[model samples]
Target: MPDAAPVLIAGCGDVGMRLAALLQVHGQRVLCLRRNVAALAPGLPGFAADLADAASLRALPRGIRRVVFLPAPLAREAVAYRTVYLAGLANLLDALDEPALQRCVLVTSSAVYGEHAGAWVDEDTPPAPLGFNGAILLAAEALLLARLGESRGVVLRLAGLYGPGRTQLLDDLRNGTARVPRDPPFYANRIQVDDAAAALAHLLALPDAASVYLGVDDTPLPLHELYAALAQQLRAPAPGIGPPPPGIGNKRLRNARLRASGWAPRWPDTRAGYAALRVDPA
Candidate 1:
């Protein structure tokens, strides 16, 4: 990676913005791209483009060495997933100048692994997506590698993302609305948003990064156990017995590959991550 070349982060939202900050702190030039450039901080360079519309991405910045595809779907439907993860990703890759591009990292999800029946999953685990969201994202992952080749194409399969603004778990615990099934032992996997961003930064600088990596933390607890831990931390009542959260798979992810790459999360445990959020909700 050239020190003077800039890293372009497509779909610069909360996590993307956080990544840009981390890259900047390391003396790397950063450029952001998203639909709403006005939301970006003052003096931050960016471009306004809708990934769904290929024509809108024609004016992308040139000489981009590293790219991060991190767009979120506009809706929860299958069409939304296809449009953002598939069509949007295709559009961005087609529009970017590739001569200078060294790597293109796609921020995907662990949902692609589908339900694992409380078993452990790793990068080599075959993807068995169960729903439209996971299916489309899996397709998108294929498309990225097909377009960028194995060396340049990289995927970070992140688990559930939570941080300062994402407080539904806390609210549910406080309101006594949180519930999970205890008999089957549905598992939960998650990584703090800041840690997620840091992982992205870590992969960007890796010279021989693998084609895929699971971006989870050190622990994957059963849903009931996680909620109980959070409730204990909050001094609130335990969650009730009910169906597990909809649309997520039951699996435990291992971060050994990413850890072996010399990138360990600052908060390896979700409990400590949440505690930090409580102390400094920035």
Candidate 2:
């Protein structure tokens, strides 16, 4: 990493903005990079730099000591995942001009744990990806860690993200797509979008941050229970009980490590996060 104080936020989006604000307040200069420069909020220091296009990233601001890469996939398929997550990181690293870059933070997914079959997962668990998303992300994670030799790379495996403007779960319940699986319950884990941002900032500030961390909230609830609660709140018909669709399974994720570090989520559970969406059923 560079000896300078410049921080690079690649693929800056909602979480990126949160990190940018924290870094700025701490008296560090920050640069935001995304595929579309116009999407960047006004007054933000950013430019259009696509990780797919290594050429465009060649001119990324120098003197960057730390980098946080959090890019959304361009498509839903495996190929798209490869392009954005794997190829993107490869291209970004290859194009960096900074030699003082000390640490690179890569935001991945808990899907990499695949079928833990209702078992709890932590940072040290060996990843056994069952699905394509998990496999690809695991591949990308391996690429980043190997490239940086683990010491200078941190992989944050984020759970499902939700918050304001991210009302997909609420929408699912309202639209009757929410399900209540029978005997076997599919466990769900998550972290609020805001907390997701805060976690990244917290990791960046730590001098001895672990190379891998599970970014999850305090509670890991069953999908059936979560849906039932949401349905009752919305005064909608309770979701019908049925078997889970293929590819979904039960798995609990623990964030004891993150909480022990003094970073706690503001919305710890379904109740706290969805309380606002509880419209009067009258």
Candidate 3:
């Protein structure tokens, strides 16, 4: 035995479970922690702990070497973002300060870029969050960088996640609720859920992970294009064009930095990724 604690996945949800599966295939045991232990995968030991509660974090195992912190806010509001991304992350960091810790990889949002004019962004682009959602995530990243530096921790800003069982786009198009930006053809990035999880695991083993990397697919497409594809698949009416929605990010996310790190998404584009996904009407 390595005489070390299992890898800790704080907030082990669907993506976390995916990461855990990948790691376990390589003979690694992962400690799964979340507010709802029942949600964890079978055959894995899980702890019910809320990152927002400092005391609950005390239940974290000793001798943890690596941590993947990925807690999603229960809501999209600012206060909810602050409580989960900021306070919850702070509590976890406070609880795990052991010398045995090797790295802490954080999953964040691409909203931190704040580019609403179809600009291309990457790790080097200075984060200028325009909304509270981006602001909260940026604040968390700042805190993480200040607290752990590049050697001990890194951040992964992921694009929109879509994959099996996650078909909001399909649902919207099928229900005649999908809207596309008419003028600028609102553009954004996306990554399949499996790719997001794989990116985290890739960061886990990289010898020199950068301070930050954008987790997105190679293709950045207009909202209408994505919607149209789903419409065709669902045999529904094409999505109508309208003014851009409030949070429909108008920027292109670049994944070269992550790709340069030798990680490429299996589903490199929305067309290929969404091919096998179907929205369940039940």
Candidate 4:
């Protein structure tokens, strides 16, 4: 493989770390920017910068050819979601012009297609966000798309991500707080962290300009099944089955667009993904 361009990962969280590792393995100079630089790999170059402060963003090293923008934890809260989303993105964009940056990949979520009750959501699916989080994500998508026309950029709408240090269900199970709603037929999509990282690497290597892709596995497992698998894996007592609360049922997402892009997932289903996590929890 040819040497990759200098890449900057804005958020060195679980996904960010995986991306950074892969970029480094591919022979790219990676610079990670995050509030907690200690969380990143010790050998990787990282910059401590507050996502909310535009001035701090200016400190990002210039001559960055590629960038992966991962939303900070601040985007999770309902109230502060939009402010941080818009402000953080705008601040980053203001820090550098497109001519100086070769390409950018914005990591977004499937929440933009909020509450997909039995409906299959894909890249072309119109966003119908329900709650504040989804609304903010949708707004962020719009802003990113608007800027995409001006630069070589793409948006990756990822499914529920799981892998090393990010076992969402496993974490709940270990804490003895795994909640399994009684509602049957309620399923959700997921993708392993390694798969997500590979998808990003594939996009970065492609010669294409701008595109929107859904990063998800082939199977969308039922919520109860997911919890039960975790319980079994951990040898812990399974949560009592109960009816799923209103508006919190199965949501399936389609990744036909991404699959069509010549990138195949190593973990095509959640069962395989979860099975791989059966070893040490750490």
Candidate 5:
């Protein structure tokens, strides 16, 4: 493939836009694909095509060298996930000329680990996904590798993402609506949105990127402790004890492999990250 070939970002959204900005700073040619071209920023080169509709993808730009697939489903249902992650990914790969493509990175979630109960998980951990989302994503990961070869496929299993406009946790804490499980100490892991975008860009430039990497920050605090700290930061009343959040497996994600690959998070700890948000809204 020629070096001039554009890097295609499938399912372009918040993280995709951030990654595109990073790549554009370095003068890399970026092409974005999404359902709505109008939603894209002012001058970004993009195409409007729904991944669920195979025929719509036929008109995509040709000879794309690399891809970043980080699509979000229309809803939180099983059918939505299957359509977007599994069938949508399949349609994209099939539509493209696979021979000329160098890499296709998929942004999946850590839910694949499924209820670790405060245990630690790494990329090497065998996936035991419990919910439909995780199971379908695991299947999508397999499909990517099977179609594009393992060496050319990359999977980023990201922890909870929070930053910028994604401040629901902070809002909940401020209004005393936040509730967390405290008896068993449910763990929470996350990466700031900027850091998550940086990680995606890092993998794109990595020459010897691994097949799978965990996208999480350094600290994985217990849910109650994290909520308490946020409450303290906001000077609000602490959240009441309640049940753990559904479907999110309780495990501390280890990003050792990704860190070892020469990538580090700007926000290693959520406390400091959240503190920055307090000082400056965005």
Candidate 6:
């Protein structure tokens, strides 16, 4: 496939937009599909189409060589979690009929590993998702992997992501209202948005079959320690720490698979990423 063929990004959220920008900078054509075109940054080709609508998606621009499936946001109060998640993915997979499509990268979450407490979990680990969100992600992974043939498909299980315009933990710390789970210091992993984008870029450039890679930093930090450091950087009050609520616990994801693929994260840990955020306040 030519390097200039448009890469289709299904959902143009924070990470999706950043990935599109990086691909655009590298002179790759980026076609972002979303419910709202206004959400995409200017100058990037965007199509205002709903993934829920199969017909509209089937008509995507031609010569799209790569597809990045970012999960669409669901209603917090929606009663049909499985239906929405499966239906959206099914529609997209059905819509693509282009024989030239060579690569597909589906963004799954590390939540599939469930609450790891302090243990390191990798791609090979058996998925034991805890809640509905985790269940849905695992289901999605199965769906994509089942349909993925020799088209160089990939499943990227990303940890908690934090970057510009998408900073919940940092924001909470800066406001001096950050809360930690009551359980003992449990480990959590994260990837800087830019590093995540870089990993995707690297995977796309590779000539291979389907693979499952974990997207996480080298070091996993306790949730409290990360917030504490953030509070110090912001010069705000040391935020109050509490235990994770009943259902929500800590998780540590291993990135050895991706690292072994010759992709090293610029920010290998939450502390480093958080510090950089303070310096530039992203």
Q: What TM-score goes with each of the models?
A: 0.95, 0.91, 0.94, 0.88, 0.96, 0.90
| Candidate 4 lDDT (Cα, 0 to 1) | 0.75
What lDDT tens digits, residue by residue, belong to model 2 across residues 1-282? 323466788889888887788777777778898978788766678878778888988887666778999988887799889988999999988877536768899999988886777888898888888788889989988898888866478888999888767877677777887766756778878788888888887777667777788999888888788778778888877787767645534688899888887798888895567776444346
Model 5 spans with C-alpha error above 4 angstroms: 279-282
Q: State how far residue 42 of model 4 sits from its true place (Å).
A: 1.5
The weakest ten consecutive residues by lDDT in model 5 span 273-282
Better of 2 and 3 by lDDT: 3
> Which residue pairs clash within candidate 6?
180-242, 181-242, 181-243, 181-244, 182-242, 182-243, 182-244
Model 2, stretches more than 4 Å misplaced?
Answer: 1-4, 245-248, 276-282
lDDT of 3 by residue, 1-282 (tens): 331468899889999999988888878888888889887788777878988899988867777889998987888898888998899988988898656768889999898877558888888988887788888888888888888888578899998999987867777888898878757777858999999999998898787778999999999988888778767767889988787767535889999999999999999988878876644233
CA lDDT for candidate 3 = 0.84
lDDT at residue 101 of model 3 (Cα atoms) = 68
- Cα deviation in Å at residue 128, candidate 4? 0.4
Candidate 4 lDDT, 38-157, residue by residue in tens? 878777888898777889888676677777888665635775676567778778878866567667788878777756666777877777766666677777767876775533678888
Decreasing TM-score order of the candidates: 5, 1, 3, 2, 6, 4
Better of 3 and 4 by lDDT: 3
RMSD of 3: 2.2
Candidate 6: global Cα-lDDT?
Answer: 0.76
Worst 10 residues of 4 by lDDT: 241-250
Evaluated with lDDT, which candidate comes out highest?
5
Model 4: number of backbone collisions: 4
- Model 2 TM-score, 2 decimals: 0.91
Q: Which number leads on TM-score?
A: 5
lDDT of each: 0.88, 0.81, 0.84, 0.75, 0.89, 0.76
Mind giving the per-residue lDDT tens digits that candidate 6 earns over 152-190? Answer: 568888887877667777667777677775457767678
As for model 6, its CA RMSD to the true structure in angstroms is: 2.5
In model 3, where do residues sit more than 4 Å from their true spots? Answer: 1-4, 278-282
